[model samples]
Target: MRITEPYTIFLRRLPSGKSVYYYQFRDEDGKRSPAYSTGTNKIAQARRVCQRLYNEGKFKKSNEILFKTFASGFFDDESDFCKWKEVNGSSLAKSTIASYKRLLENQILPFFGSMKLKKINTDTVKRWIVWCSEKCSAKTSNNAQSVFNIIMKSAKEKKLISEVPSSELAFRKIKKKERELLTVEELNRIYHSPLWGWECARRAFLTCAITGMRIGEITGLQTFEVGDDRLNVEHTLHPKFGLGPTKTRVCRFVPIPKSLGLKRQCGKTWAFEKPTEEKPCRADYIYGKLMLICDSLGIDHKARGITVHSLRNMFISYMRGSSFGETIDLKIKAVVGHADESMTDWYTYWKPEMFPEIYEIQEKLFKEITEV
Candidate 1:
């Protein structure tokens, strides 16, 4: 009945009157190994020996579990493994969990699932990478490898392995593609066009273009978060995950122009409420309107891979191209909530009133979009 990590220990006596501790271990599947003696008469000494052997990976039977069995329900939100991960302070977002599950089910599990946990080594991983390279893009192979690393680390935590085999492995290089950004002239074309309908979609697109907010951030923006000449970006609306913290999980204050006229309706909380609807505008609807506007103006949006997210690119590029020079560097990062910036608190201090230059630039941009 005595239980310890990696093994359950019990005492047994021989005919010669000497007592020794026997230990039994279980695999990831909960199948127990046969009892083996610790050859120690003292329980305290026996427990230490058991721990030492466990640390050294002497419980070979536990490592015999198949990789697929070991990874079962690992990415499932309700699984014991996932719950354990949360309790251990590594809780993942719902969207992240879903992505891990996709990688596991589609890539990692299929390659290593039949192999024993002990059999997965550097050679095996390299072979899997080779197989993945032939079957998918480098980006997908890279993601699959990352998910594989997580599983192996979890196995190491459970003492199933002494170390993660993929630790020294290198990922495939990914080719970076530049995201398309709309030009100032193009923005003017869309805004000034009488053909453009969908008032909510246009407002949201304008907000994104001016502030570099992601489509999700634009949708999640509330009336209360809007100030006289600034918007507090505290949340993002995911179609699948609904309302969540900003992508960086850090709130940012983006300077806006009062001329943009973003306001809350009497019964609406969303800054960009859809016509009579109480909910925020859908990202797809906004994207559709953008593409249509581009088509009516003879802009090849599809050829240039323009999407709603392109507005963010447009905002960053426009700010960088502006005459303000280096003074506006940190302000752009803060407005976009760049996760890697360590001076987020410092950047947040650039309030709309304090930095009239930002409003000046935004007002100029707004005038271009609204005026002929």
Candidate 2:
């Protein structure tokens, strides 16, 4: 009855003419379990069944399993991973959860769907990153890595895997080029191009420039969010998900220019009529309009040379060159809804109107530089 390493089962013939087989093994966790195979008189077949039970940790009626395998088992039990995401993704923002669902649908599930959780490893993850990088942008690749890391980390926290591969190993770096802000001349060219003719496209780009708001913030704007002589940057409309809080989760207001003719229609409503519920304007809608304008203007939409985000950068650059030079950083941060201003060394009390003087100075500098 001595059971040692490489233990074997011996079939014993009972008085009833029945044979029994036994098998045992030490798991990676150093636990042992035994099981009986079918009434095969053959030792090898019993040994094979024993090995299968041992590897799967199903030898005993009740043995705790690794979290990784447990999650995989759960995944197998249900065809849809969205249920798991919703249950486990509570900590993530709604928009983030939606994005995770998309990534899983478009990328993760397609490759790993049939595989057991225990089977996923550094090599497989790295290959997935390579594939994602080939088909997507560097930012997209990074986002996918982030989402995958979060899911795996959640799995590990719940004891799905013994350990998660180091993030350094899981994510491959894709070098991104520095983004250049658009010049005034270039901005003029882009604005004059037929692509900028759409009201939404023109309004979205101009709003970003004037208020230094992110594209999301600009696109999420509702007539209700606009106050007398000011626009609020409180929320953003995600491309895939609907309206959510701003990226920084902080709200700020930008002074509306008289040029836009924004006024209060009556006691409770602002001058800009609120969009109808049936067709509420969204960031993606604005972006689509901008893309259409670019196409009509024959601009290279895919080129890294120019982007809608450049409007915000241009606003920053222009503000920095104004009389509010010293306070430009803080002012920009305030209007742009940046959460912190440690990197920007200006007092926070400055008003957005101070940008006008800076704009005047920038105009002079621009004239001197361009001689136009």
**In lDDT terms, which candidate is top?**
1
* True lDDT of residue 154, candidate 1: 86
What is the C-alpha local distance difference test score of each model? 0.80, 0.58
TM-score of each: 0.79, 0.58
- Residue-level lDDT of model 2, residues 172-275, one tens digit each, is 56676666665666555555555543344554565566667888776667767776557766778776766787886666677756444444431133222224
Off by over 4 Å in 1: 1-60, 84-90, 264-267, 343-354
Off by over 4 Å in 2: 1-94, 114-124, 168-171, 177-181, 186-201, 238-241, 257-260, 264-307, 320-327, 338-372
Question: What TM-score does candidate 2 get on C-alpha atoms?
Answer: 0.58
Q: How do the residues 115-181 of candidate 1 rate in per-residue lDDT, one tens digit apiece?
A: 9998889999999999999988999899989999988998898778888999999999988766566
Error of 2 at 208 (Å): 2.0
Model 1 accuracy (lDDT, Cα): 0.80
Task: Write out the backbone clash pairs for model 2.
Answer: 67-159, 67-160, 68-160, 68-161, 195-293, 263-271, 322-358, 323-358
How much is 3 displaced in model 1, in angstroms? Answer: 19
